[model samples]
Target: MDKILEAVVMSSYPNNVKQGLVRRVIEAAKQPMDSEQCWSMLELSTKLYLLGDTKYKREIGKEVLEVYGHYHPEEFEEFFNVRFLLSLLQEGYGPLGKRSHYVLDYIQLGLQFVLESPSANSIFGLLRIEVLRKVCERPSPKQCAKISKLLIQHPQCIPVGKHQVLFCQQLIRCIRQFQCVSEGEEDIMEFLEQVNKVSGLLQRIWRTQTSVILPSLKELFTIISSTETRNDLMYLVFLVTNIFIAGAHPCLAEEQEAPSNALASVVQFVPLELMDGVIRNLTNDDSITDVQMMTAIGR
Candidate 1:
């Protein structure tokens, strides 16, 4: 590891560069090594990335990905430290309207590799979530939404709880960015329907983490309520109401407080008729006791 680091440091010298050492560093990085050696190669990769030369950066990125793939998925957690990889992947967010195409491509490449690999274990899923979370910081909204949908649909990929809530927040952000212009109306409505289908999953997520997911839920309310067509609005109403009902279940009484707060946030967007329907639906459900019904009505 020291030898690798020393070679990298020496290659950093001015015009009197050690091309021999640089070649050797790259060669050594390609071979399987202990964690320490992987760490050193990663540091070298970061330096290459910082140079901002497209060729060098892409080569380094590919090399790193290949190196990662060498480790078996079941043992991946023991071999590579996720924090170190995350640190190396970071690129400062560019100004608004500017995109980090290079960084995004590298991340997507890694994500694709993970997704296509034979293993759908929680570890790969966790890493994918981390990578996706970074993308959320400066997202290409539509692309992010597509990736989120893929991840959500992947069986046994994303672990529940905090990761799910975090992903949900980003998914909401992506949805909120749609302009709803007529030119893109079909695509926009399709995207909204896809989101609606996932409401049960989102509802379960909300039931467990109501407080953490409240803001995103409220944002979703605003997005749905702002739909240009009444038909679109009515369709979205089902999604939001389904999510709320999950938390309102009698078994989840202990989880109801924060969702009630979220209900308050929903009032601003919900039409009177929609509210009446939701209330009616709740009242008709035999599973909800009178106490639970009145409590929901009061909210």
Candidate 2:
């Protein structure tokens, strides 16, 4: 019966009448609703997205999001359209008022779909990069933390390509812009852990696409420059130096000359003052071999 009503309203009613009905239904949805009533209203609200122009589209999208908040749909992609949600995230996030609160949830959903699909090498790759770039542009503390954790926990999930370099760059940008290493030991440790994963990922990228990874080294330097506290600064320099060393180390005999040149390129970006601390930290780390230290310092 509800589907029949939707078909009739969509096909028979004039635009103005349908608009009026949509407004009424949206207003009515603000009141308390049982599960069945909420489901019906949700369907109607989603359909209204197809009914009117931009004005009604925002209205309908907000209404559907409200329903989603109430129910927390298990199959989010199935319950609501991912592309439509991405459009709202791209354009309507600010205008949608409180409905924009779910931006993180939608971003995660969008990323998951793109990563799980077989064609991540194609348009989905671009889509993930765009979505990540958007988060970096206006990163909140929570969003920064979430994205960092995602990168740390699932670095393998990100498919390899130039997109991987872009993803790492933006993730580093997010950390540099929004994250701070607090005084607490746990906070500092977590920050280091995140940095470790980021640098490890970058080292891997550098090994595969040494040419493309140069731009990302700049982001790594920004993370060190943006460090607020002395402890954080030292730790960032140390970790970043290791990333440079790993990148500069020759894996094969043919690339021996290239390793020193690569390390020189990276060294040029390090702050002159921090060079002392980088050497100090590398010396302090008992795990670092004499050859690695020489490679890092002499080159």
Candidate 3:
């Protein structure tokens, strides 16, 4: 029934087509329908007018969202809003494929909506992560810092399963870019951001019980552990791991009761031969040692 009515709205009307399309949806939205149909009609109405500069679409969209909110308010609102904003992004791309400010606003609004709503665990976080990755690719330092920091704090922003692998890959790419592009003081700051990003990634590992992130983790370790690599990067990775470890450094005995110590988990992940080489290289280098790191190793 809903589909048949939707087809009516979607079909061409000879006169006052725009207003007619919207009127039909509003009439449909007022009818008795299932939750899905109610939501769909609302979205269809938005499609007709959201891009208009006037309050025309906004008012109708709000009414539809409100009506849907009466059924499964939180989930329905967020789901519909995300889809609507993504559509705007699709339409906002310019003739030359450059990101338009219109789209940026949509992205920002979408992210804000995600932040304000309850998480469906990592589902929303992944959406936020994808958005952040898009922003980072364009390399807006200010926007990157803002969004990354927000994602770091979001419990759902955890890098796990496939995301853990993706997070590491992107971090490695970021580090490589840092190496090529940074110089002097800018180098130091960018390196610090990378370090924090690594630490932010670290938070995800605790909940991750499987060896899923291992391959990419090893790749990251290889880069940071290599002797030819910069000292700050090495120290950053070490610091990140130490910070993420389960127990406080001073209370070794207290930490020992758990069979799965964070330090041990990491130790088990690193191949023994690679570990030896990293230790061997560190011995020959003048890089500063992290005392907390030794404690984690001791654990």
- Candidate 3 clash pair list: none
Tens digit of lDDT per residue, candidate 1, span 231-256?
22223334345544543211111221
Full candidate order by lDDT, most accurate first: 2, 1, 3
Cα misplacement distance, residue 40 of candidate 3 (Å)? 18
lDDT by residue for model 3 over 172-288, one digit each (tens)? 444333321334565545544544454344435433533544555544544434334222222333533664453222112122222111222233344454556565654554543
Error of 2 at 107 (Å): 4.5
lDDT of each: 0.45, 0.46, 0.44
Question: Which candidate tops lDDT?
Answer: 2
lDDT of 2: 0.46
TM-score of candidate 3 on Cα atoms, chains taken together: 0.37
**Backbone N/Cα/C clashes per model:** 0, 0, 0
Best of the candidates, TM-score = 1
Q: Which rank order by TM-score, best down to worst?
A: 1, 2, 3
List candidate 2 segments past 4 Å from native.
1-80, 91-102, 106-126, 135-138, 148-163, 178-212, 218-299
Per-residue error at 40 for model 1, in Å? Answer: 2.7
